[model samples]
Target chain A: MIDKVIIAEDQEFANLSVQKTMDDLKVKQYDYAFYCDDALAKIQLAQKKGEPYDLLITDLSFEDDGTAQKINDGIELIRAVRSIQPGILILILSGQYRPVDIHNLFENHEVDAYVRKARHDVQELKAAMDALSKGQRYYPRSLAQLIKRSNTYEFTEFDITIIRLLSEGYQQNKIPDYLKEHNIKPSSLSSIEKRLNQIREELGFANNQQLMVFCSNAGLL
Target chain B: MIDKVIIAEDQEFANLSVQKTMDDLKVKQYDYAFYCDDALAKIQLAQKKGEPYDLLITDLSFEDDGTAQKINDGIELIRAVRSIQPGILILILSGQYRPVDIHNLFENHEVDAYVRKARHDVQELKAAMDALSKGQRYYPRSLAQLIKRSNTYEFTEFDITIIRLLSEGYQQNKIPDYLKEHNIKPSSLSSIEKRLNQIREELGFANNQQLMVFCSNAGLL
Candidate 1:
């Protein structure tokens, strides 16, 4: 049960909307901050008071006021809050719709959930809160699809090394010689060819060039 | 020489920051609105007075204040404003970093420029304004890179049709039958094979499956 919550949003109406959602959820112990610095200060103060917040809902983009804030954005705030309270749940509530940026939030920032502020966002926020109550992370469907699509092929170190070599203009036959020189295990012509073929089959690439392109575009190499 | 500008931002500090930028550029006849509806009304009023805005700078996300609004988001506001004054220059000023979304703004909404809110955003905003003055659209380097990467292949209608059929699990040999039935040109097996090979070479695909995957990922099909 989330007894304590803090929302860091700059917009008055957005903060009010979030408050309305919390009210609907019957969550009473919630605080709001309009800036990242204020949000960080509240979290730190709460920690010092021995009454830490259970969840932190924040927006990624904050309007810069030229006040020279220490924590400028939500990402920085999350990092600061995490350092102060390592176990606090973080839910990103913003209008950001970038798959790569959202993916980074989960992979790097350890955000508990991402709720896009859009049509039906209020309902989605309710659903996300429910999921978080059960200790499960929630991601919007589009972001989830992106994550799943990228995770379709789990590229091992061996696969990445081979792909990197191929991307560097190394021929399949010459890869074995280079691998052997580098003391890489299973550095045979057949192994290299088989691995290459396996990767192509797995990724549904028709040729080495296509595989390289996919790797490059997907940011694997 | 740019003269008039209207900044539609929700935050007071952000609005002030934009005002500072405009002041720096010596643009005197500028207006400000806190809500999209208000911005639209201002534009409509300006049109009624026979003096439409020279430029419209808006943020994509607007905090919904629970009051029913005719123009809810910047995109909707842009559309509304465009219908009123089609020749008005639009520059999106926000912290939105999504490439796909930004590309859509340029391609679909006809936004003249997008200046992300960052450390050097004030300077970039100046540059964007200068470009607009010279009749050149300005996109941040990151967004420009995305446009370039996506434009790597200008897929023809025929190519898209072929790739679509292939994505639908149509075999290479069987595509001719489907194509002939649909009255698609170059339905011969040899033609189809050569075309597929040509597409693979163009897109650096190693095989048909890779092409399908790439097409699916790229949203071509």
Candidate 2:
């Protein structure tokens, strides 16, 4: 399980540098490519040759000018490999910042680890390799923090509109009339109360006042 | 195990809002406070009363007045609880932007989950609770992306210095003298070769040429 590896980076120098680094460490078996397509092909070859690619190291952005369209981006490559071999542990190396894209990748693509380009000269890189060798996902401390910090609460647009109106000093009894005037859905008093109650229960609030306070403090209002 | 809970928030409105949310949900069994100290007291009291606190909801920052020292911030509370009770689950409610700090909290503080305080309504709050109740750590998808985008090859400070010299057009054999001139620790020629070989092996490079090319493309050259 720890014998083979493959890297799909566009930069020849990076690929060669990593190869030399691995050689210095006495690691004998590995593969490399300068584009996503070649990397994907190699992975398929490895699988067909009865030696599946164990680790896939890829750069998120590619400058492959050979193709007219951006057909072999790193994100697309990750999706491709995942579609065929869902068990393959994929790691991404990006030079730029794209939080939303990466988030979508983790939620939809099932990446096993992430490392930053800055760690090429730091001990963090060694830590990533160590973690990967153990069959455990390794995220550089920076990346872990990025992935773990978020304020995503699953509220619909309708809920937000109602909360906004309530925070503006509109009474609950009058909200339905305002909502109806604004062409909002579920513009009924009972339904509005139900939604408010649902929100209160979800946030562990005791009453409408408490819910309103929470919305205000969270900047939702 | 399912009864006691703790809230460590600095904002009075946020604190009260969460408490009210809990109350509305019919969760009258938990403890509440506006500061970390009071939260800690509640935890300690619960322990003394033979009922350990179960869930901890906290924020990372406090509103300091510049008079007295900030006592027992949310992160500190987490550390304290881990010291007193290592198995207790911790959830962080924060609005801080530094990914490194969030990473440290996860790596060192062992916070189980994180939620952001950004334009959120009650529905989002409820989703967080649902995830918490399921014994799964809830992180915003955006945060997850930040952590999972890097696949770096490790290098040491010495390697960095060497690469700097190498990038400046210094020949392989001339690197040692440059290092010595720069007050770097002297390494034998054989060791230098060995180190380069180690780098090669670790990164799975095919040869020295490959290493150089890879480094150049990755901007490490």
Candidate 3:
């Protein structure tokens, strides 16, 4: 379990909000650093002091005094930590939310989760902690749905209908009456039922209930 | 205080996802409905049965009956409930993130909170429940900051600086050195110090630490 956490962000408001959230969660002990450099120092110091942090929370943009194009900001922070301590969890909480920024955070840097500071709920940090404690990757539910929907193929109208109906607990016998009442004719009733079953089979649902839960979790329901 | 919740979403997945979340929270006794009509009926029935719901969770869109118009969406659902149960806590969880949609939810309908289905963390839902239980408004911290920065002009750069330095336990004398290091020549050092004092005065902060905590909680830090 990740017993200790370190928050690094030069922005005063963001840093304080995170700290208060941790406090509200009644976290027993933790350390916070205001700058990226000091954050690194603290991480290394913890290692030296024999009480290393299990998680790192950082923002992407910080006060960069140097002109050298730093490869690391938040992304590099994770990379550096991974180089030294590969198993340590990294979560990025930043105001940046451009698609490119999200892609870079997820694809190149391999961050455990990337939370946009602009859309964050305190539960996000707690969820990250919960995920770590439970030995699971803690991606935001919304982000997961986004990634799944964006990368996966868009659902066809018919596919949506079948899934929607099945999710509503419509038995094969009841669907035709509902479809007829709704005035849409996809095919023969058996074919419609077969297609529904086919879709369920493809999605690996054991029953209509499982399919509903699947779509619901995927944010498609 | 809200031991029971009512969900009014057309999608079975959404309804079940909410049910699962409620179950995860150990809120064992809750009810849901498939359509707005059914949901409204359930609420009325619960009221008549002397077990009125404390919260209403609804989705903005419904796939039922091939309805595409945005007229009777989540906002409409909120308005419907308000007419009968004006004091009921309402939460909108939707995939949409349009500024117009959010504005209508908060400004026009006065929803307790707007959670984007795409960005919401389940842990955030828990945190929100915690706050709601205490009768305090709970918004995702990131969203609060974004709204504060984008919608209001009350927070100035100097105010942010003061918040940052104070949060880090930097004394008044040391704050000027911190500003100078940042290369932000906001008139003279005394002027900068005066700005901090003025902010302190305006916010009714007794000390720099108080200002820092206030800003943090307000999403201004």
Q: Which residue segments of model 1 deviate by more than 4 Å?
A: A1-54, A58-86, A94-114, A119-221, B1-49, B56-86, B92-111, B116-136
Residue lDDT tens for model 1, A130-195: 999999988877767866686577677788888777655566778889988989888998998898
Give the DockQ ranking, best first.
Answer: 1, 3, 2
Clashes of each: 5, 52, 4
Model 1 clashing residue pairs (backbone): A204-B210, A206-B206, A206-B207, A207-B206, A207-B207
* Model number with the top lDDT: 1
True-structure lDDT of candidate 2: 0.64
What are the iRMS values of all candidates? 10.1, 32.0, 27.6
Better of 1 and 3 by lDDT: 1
- Model 3, CA-based lDDT: 0.63
Q: What DockQ number belongs to candidate 2?
A: 0.01
Residue-level lDDT tens digits of model 3 in B50-84: 88889988777654345444335566777777887
Q: Weakest 10 consecutive residues, lDDT, candidate 3 chain B? A: B212-221
